[model samples]
Target: MKSLNDIKNIAIILTLAYAGITVTFLTYMATSVRTYNEIITYKEHEINLAFGYLFLIGMFTLVVLLLFLFYRAITISNRLLQQADRASGNYTIVESVELDKERRANEEKMREAKLLFDKEVESKLTAMLIFSPENLAEDTAFLEAIMLKMAKEFSAVQGLAYKYNKTNKAFELAATYAYFSENVKQSFTLDEGIPGQVAVKKESLKINNVPQGYLTVLSGLGKGTPSALYVIPIVVDSETVALLELAFFNNIDELLQQVVEQLEPKLGNIYAKFLK
Candidate 1:
């Protein structure tokens, strides 16, 4: 296809050629009329003058027509260039939008896959705990194992299991996993902090924000506050047997929360037998 530049170049060359031809023809006619007027008879001079006037008129009209055609060509080329630029810009914008949509779709698929994997792991762990030998639930070592498993599975920064002390009328810390604090209280009354409250109410609570000075999370890096907390009460036979506390640097999502909730009933049965 001929480009706009090629067409413009052709139009310019034609216009210049027409102008040159017009100038050359006028010069030739003027010189011829001057020579004829000096050499020819008066009657012949008059007749030649009439012919020269007609030829001059015709050449002028032709020059005007060529100039008009050249101007029209330039105008058409400019319009075509503008349209091409606009089309190119629109194509770029559309391509960018399509890429963004594809990126978002890929991210969504990854998120869904991660959720499914987590759910499967949680289900398997629940079945394992439920079907274990009856002797495992009666030993202190089993309580520690359960705490460790819960902390690892949930990615908790710290985990504490508090068995209800009937003699002392308090919840005593029975097991700890990934915990770095020695200053923590050994036990809590039924009305004390969030854990105590969950034990009294016999309901689970998910806290997205922990108040300042309420709790401090310790790690090898340093000590800092946790962003979220979970207080779950283990109940069996209409009585609270133990309370489980978990702390994390990030907020827990709904899928993990649902898994934890499902595990509570089975844990309640195990803890009841172990605490006895």
Candidate 2:
């Protein structure tokens, strides 16, 4: 179909042509009336003048009618073009929004897949620790190895392993990793403190914002209080057998929690063997 602009142009051209023809015919009639007035009788001249005026009026009316039609056509075509442009703009905006949504969804899926892959790798590694040569020797050696592995994996400044002593009715320190304090508490009964609470509850504990004078981490340059503490109890057959404590300079996050989840079961099974 012809575009609006093309139709408007055609209408404009026709209007100008009709206006030019009207002007020419008006000039010719004026000249003819002058000629008739000079030669003819008064009555005939008056009649011819009336006929000439009527023809001129008819021609002028047709010119005005064409011009009005042309104006309406131009107005209609402009409105149609503006509507088309607005529709096109709206479609583009909708498409852009859809693309943005798709991109965000793809990014989320990729993040979830990476998390799953990392959890799998960590699970396999923690499981393989069961067959390590150092961990195969004895109970204390196994506990020490496990503490060391956990401290390194979680970026802990200090770690301690405590075993429940039936005769003493308390949990006694069995192994330490990166421990620097000589006056650190070595034993606790049920309901004594955080460690004792974990022992009694048989569940893990997480503490944040350790007090200023609480446990300090010693380094070559200086010493500072740890920011976070984790106490996990090892439960086997509905009985709490051992407890693990770790202190960190930073806070733990979801990934660390998942690592603990994977390692805890393996630790419980191996330690159960040691108990046997």
Candidate 3:
């Protein structure tokens, strides 16, 4: 009852063994033919008999050695191949937006939107990193910067983004791409909404139908339109400083997923700021 791995090893050993045996046998056979003629012509009885016995024993030994070597060689080779395959198995998920369709989505609009989005992300991240130590109490300034960027990218409609401040007990306007009532920027207490729950637990939460839930009031979002909202809490030094919230965007999560993987190590480098 050999294990699978053991059997594989044995197979390779047998292959090498056979190869070696075949080569040795062929070489011996060719030399023996000429030697046989010499033996008969010279009448060297003792020498001929000794050579004959030695040839037979050598053939037997070669066969056994060749079988052993072949199995070992192949088994080792197979195991190495399996290990190599495992090392390269990791893969990253890619968005499947059609290149032609997205390209034609609005060349000028897309170009402007991309530029705006890049500036917005850079702006937001830099501001948060800078203002985090100062204790950002209001979302007024931060959200406005993000919203301006979003508007430049997608002008068709407006978008809204928020962040939860557990200490302040409110949902601050993190970013918006459209105009909305000023009341929409109101904050909710720690015990008030799902954002608070997420902030406290330091985890993300999503609710599809906000009006039906008793969690918190969402004012000025243009009725029950933004049914889906994503709540992502940003932690600095293991403490939830703020929640980087976004609303009314279907593809934001996918984009964030990709960015998070890329941004993870980068955030680590910012440690150099504190070291010096």
Candidate 4:
């Protein structure tokens, strides 16, 4: 059904038609009364009655003209209504097409996201299932070998080692490998810096910013390039003994966190090895 506005327009056209009709009737009656009065006067020239009849004819003709014009206007309005309806339908079709395209685009994006998530899960699983303890020996040597293997596989940039020093209440460097150079300080003590902080707290440390000073305090592993570092400790018999540190290039960030998470469990039974 059409809205009230359309009905209102129709009502207005009806009212105008009524008004035109009323005017036409009033003009015809006025002309008849005037013609009668002029004919009754009987004085003056015959010219008066002739003129009055001509005026009456002209008024009647005008009423017909007005009705014809009104009819033409109604037809024009109907054509406009049809044009408007077609435009509205065209707009609706276009909107529906756009909605369908958007739905397909969103579905494609979701599929890609799921595939990426699955790939990452597979990568972590591969890293964790290296070897079962029943199939391999549980020794520090073996652990180190595993670490090395994983590092290579993961494209690790450096391997670091630290041992807690109860005597100085610090962690002392036991072994270190710097991929970039042989000249990197092969050893460091807790008194030296951040590695010590990790040792003192018995908590892992991950530094996102290798400030200029910390960068200068040591160099070579990632050079000034390691913007992030992870420190994990080796614990034995409820006492902290050693630490493992890895520095990554630029932002091996999320990957490093995953590596550390995977590394922690493997050290569960043999943490005693690095204490010596």
Instruction: Quote the lDDT for 90 in model 2.
Output: 42
Best by TM-score: 2
Global fold similarity of model 1 (TM-score): 0.53
By TM-score, how accurate is candidate 2? 0.60
- Candidate 4 has its poorest 10 consecutive residues by lDDT at 214-223
State each model's CA lDDT, in order: 0.74, 0.77, 0.51, 0.60
Judge candidate 3 at residue 127 and give its lDDT. 41
lDDT of 2 by residue, 1-276 (tens): 367567568767766766676666667567774664453455756655555565676568667766777887798897788678767764357766986899899999999999887977677466536557767677778778777766666678888889889999998999998888999888999889889988888888888888877887788989988898989888888778888898888887767776676667777887788777
Sort every candidate by TM-score, greatest first: 2, 1, 4, 3
Error of 2 at 16 (Å): 39
Give the runs in model 1 whose Cα sits over 4 Å from its true position. Answer: 1-139
Q: Model 1, 1-276: lDDT tens per residue?
A: 467567567767765765676676567667774664453455756655555555666567567766866887799897787678767864357766986899899999999999887878677567537435643846455666666665666667777888887899998988887777778779999979778778888889999977775668776688888788888888988888777788887888776677777777887777666655
Superposed by TM-score, candidate 4 places the C-alpha of residue 26 at a distance from the truth, in angstroms, of 27
Stretches > 4 Å off in candidate 2: 1-131
Quality of model 2 by C-alpha lDDT: 0.77
Model 3 lDDT per residue over 1-276, tens place:
267577567656655665565566566567665655666554655555555556566567566756765876798787777677557653223322454456677897889988887776665445434434322344444444434433343221344555545556566665655445565545555544666677677665654453443222234553434444555555455645454444543334433443443343343344323323
- lDDT-based ranking: 2, 1, 4, 3
TM-score of each: 0.53, 0.60, 0.33, 0.45
Candidate 4 local lDDT, residue 40:
47
